[model samples]
Target: MMLIEETAVPETALPVAQFKAHLRLGTGFSDDDVQDAVLTSFLRAAIASIEARTGKVLIERIFSWELVAWRTGYGQALPVAPVKAIEDVVLRHMSGSEEIADPAHFRLEKDTHRPRLMPVGTVLPPVPSGGAVVVRFRAGMGAVWGDLPADLGQAVLLLAAHYYEYRADTALGGGCMPFGVTSLIERYRTVRMLGGGVM
Candidate 1:
């Protein structure tokens, strides 16, 4: 299985100014925006880290996931949470042909922890032999930073601040995420059970 980011978070949607404020950097100075690029990088890194840890997209964007088969014939759980919509599902055959699955036969089951793609009938659409199915969809809390849950927004800031402060600390240990960030994102982590895992 492979996941591809069909659309990325726009720079305009990032909270660069808010991140700067969180760092409490001095204002009204000639170099006020001097470090904006650096801060923005840290913000992006923090957002990626949080998303990786929680399987939650903070910013709205489209993604394409390709797989040979569904996790189950009943339903296929999405890799991320709060999926807003399923744009398309395409079956790609080894013969170089593609067929778009009918949306009427399938539906999106929204869940905070594990959103799923489910069939209206007994089983999901089948993938052609030696072919793959690609699921394209949009997932995220919202399009802008303001739309994020307060705790998630705070977690981003806190983690970004941690990155900014330790920019040059290469010797940092593997478990570097601060306690506040872990606590803030605790509830967002997906709980895997019964050996059910994303393929």
Candidate 2:
């Protein structure tokens, strides 16, 4: 199975100014604009890292998942959280033929952390014998910063500030997430993924 983000969060929705405010560098700090690039980079990194850890997308975007067959007969789990919609489902055959599965044949069931596509009546669209099925969907809590949960939003600011403050210190090494950031997203972390095991 493979998941691809079809569209990324829009640049205008970046929380640069809000993140700066969270850092409390001072309301009238001089040369604020001079550090825009650095600040934005930190913010972006924080957002990406947080999203990866939590399995929750902070902003709404399109995603495409492709797999040869459904993992189980009952349903297939969508890895990301708060999925807003399942746009389409298509089964591609080895002979280069494709079938758009009827939307009525499946229903979306959502929990707090993940959404799933379940067969509507114990009968799901058939998987192609030698090809893959593609699921296109949109997932996220919201598109803008204001739509994010207060704690999650604050968490991003805190993590970004941490990155900015510790830029010169390479003691932590790669992928070592900070304690505070992990604490904020612990509830959103997914325990089990589609194929089984933990995320």
Candidate 3:
């Protein structure tokens, strides 16, 4: 669909290698397979989003070629759900043992009238009754546009998860989740601290 200039080739390579190493060590996935999975997952998530809104399969779009190619290159789809799921998890984490009464209360909006992809410090409204939560996520251009470097893809997914968790915890009445972008930064003192390792 959209064309993106390929930048950060050198910057992305090392992190891609590190991401492969992490996946091998943490999940026992071979580097090649992990790459494929990430790409496939990205396509699936993109397709899911497109299908969710348009009720048409992504295969119908001319952009599907780019997505398919990315999937062919990378082994796994990016864990995009965690971007929103982290919010739910964090809410439950902060809410303690109380069961979340309904899933409908918590909603995840992807790319809703947002001009930029991955706008910084955007916060969604909290659901009423302390039970509902809403989150809006922008799909990465690399993932949505074309082949995203592994490192950048990982970073986007991590941020999605981090913000989701952070916002959800903040929405909760009690203390925030022990792990979030802010907490991880304060605790680990590194931006790369909250990688795809957690979810």
Steric collisions counted per model: 0, 0, 14
lDDT per residue (tens digit) for residues 1-199 in model 3? 1222122222222233343343443545465554544533433443343333322221211110011111111121222321212122112223433343243433333421211112123322222343322222323333232354333344434443333335435455552322332332232121222342221
lDDT of 3: 0.29
Query: Which one wins on TM-score?
Result: 1
Q: Tell me the tens digit of each residue's lDDT in model 2 across 97-161.
A: 99899999998787667578889999568889999999999888898989999889978888999
The 0-to-1 C-alpha lDDT of every candidate, in the order given, reads 0.91, 0.84, 0.29
**Comparison by lDDT, 2 against 3, better one:** 2
Sort the predicted structures by lDDT, highest score first.
1, 2, 3
Kindly give the stretch of ten consecutive residues in candidate 3 with the minimal lDDT sum.
64-73
> 30 in model 2: Cα distance from truth in Å?
9.1
How far is 154's C-alpha from truth in model 2 (Å)?
1.1
Q: Name the runs in model 3 displaced over 4 angstroms.
A: 1-96, 112-199
User: After TM-score superposition, what is the CA distance of residue 154 in candidate 3 from its true location, in Å?
Assistant: 13
* lDDT (10s digit) by residue, model 1, range 1-199: 9989889889998899999889888899987999988988999999999999999999999999999988787899898888999999999999979999999989999988888899999988999899999999999999999999999999999999999998889998896899999999999887786555533
Ten consecutive residues with minimal summed lDDT in candidate 2?
190-199
